[model samples]
Target: MSSSELVRVGIQIICEHLIEVLKEELKRSRKNYREDVDVGGLDPLEDPESYRNHLRMSENQFEELYEKVKSKIEKQNTIMREALPSRLKLQITLRYLATGDTYGTLEALYRVPRCSIGRFVPEVCKAIWEVLEEYIKVSRTNLLNNIYLVHSLT
Candidate 1:
């Protein structure tokens, strides 16, 4: 090749190599996110006493309810990350209901963002209500039937 042609090809090769190196550096920098927010540590529901105190439900009840509603409440895991566990979401919702605490209080305890807790509370409650609706309706029907039976006999 001519001298000028060779120099042009070398510069082009160097530019391509530099672009690849820059892309890799970008990937590394993205992975090294400087997250200051505390997150995902020490679930209170793991302890039986704390579970009952905070949720007003036994662990078994929590598990049963969680199982029923898990599919409804679960979120899709993306390239970003997996969503919070269904158990934790339910615990947060129950704690809010029991104590009427603000999202700030829940955020401190759960290590989730107050904004996220605000979104999660209503979504989780709706999931729980959807799962429990049948049982609630059945109980109401049984109670009304007993009342009708008593009145009819009189």
Candidate 2:
């Protein structure tokens, strides 16, 4: 495949992997919230030790987390459409690929399937890099003024 196409596929693989990690992270965070936040029962001050709360959120914190998650997700979607971009999935995927996050740990940040990530990343890598080589090599050598570099060196 062409380098750009390959790169796009590669990018997609990374994005897919990142999506998987994100999905997992999101799931894990929900679980933590379920366990720790303890929606509606008794205050910790009131009851120190039982399976106390059942509510997923307190009115305030719930509102806050909800907004943050919603905002982040929306931002991600918005970034996808933009021409100049953050490359959201790639960033997160890089984090995982670079950081070696456990699936469970990754589950907290991304609500994605690890299997899907594992399965497709190779394809994405292949697609993107192959195309990428051509894309990068197909350079337009328009000579810009070298005065900026010349001055800086002097």
- What would the per-residue lDDT of candidate 1 be over residues 1-154, giving only the tens digit for each residue? 9999999999999999999999988766655543443465335447878767777888788778889988988886543445676767878778777887777787888888777776677677667666787766556566546534532332
For model 2, give the 10-residue run with minimal summed lDDT.
77-86
Residue 130 miss distance in model 1 (angstroms)? 0.9
Tens-digit lDDT string for candidate 2 (1-154): 9999999999999999999999998767755553442111233355433212222334454334334333223223231232111222333333344455654454455544456344333333333334345544432232112322322332
Show where candidate 2 strays beyond 4 Å. Answer: 38-154
Deviation in Å, model 1, residue 68 alpha carbon: 0.5
Reference-based TM-score of each model: 0.67, 0.25
Scored by lDDT, model 1 comes in at 0.71
Question: Under the 3 Å rule for N, CA and C atoms, how many clashes does model 2 have?
Answer: 31
The prediction achieving the highest lDDT against the true structure is 1
Q: How close is candidate 2 to the true structure, as a TM-score?
A: 0.25
TM-score result, candidate 1: 0.67
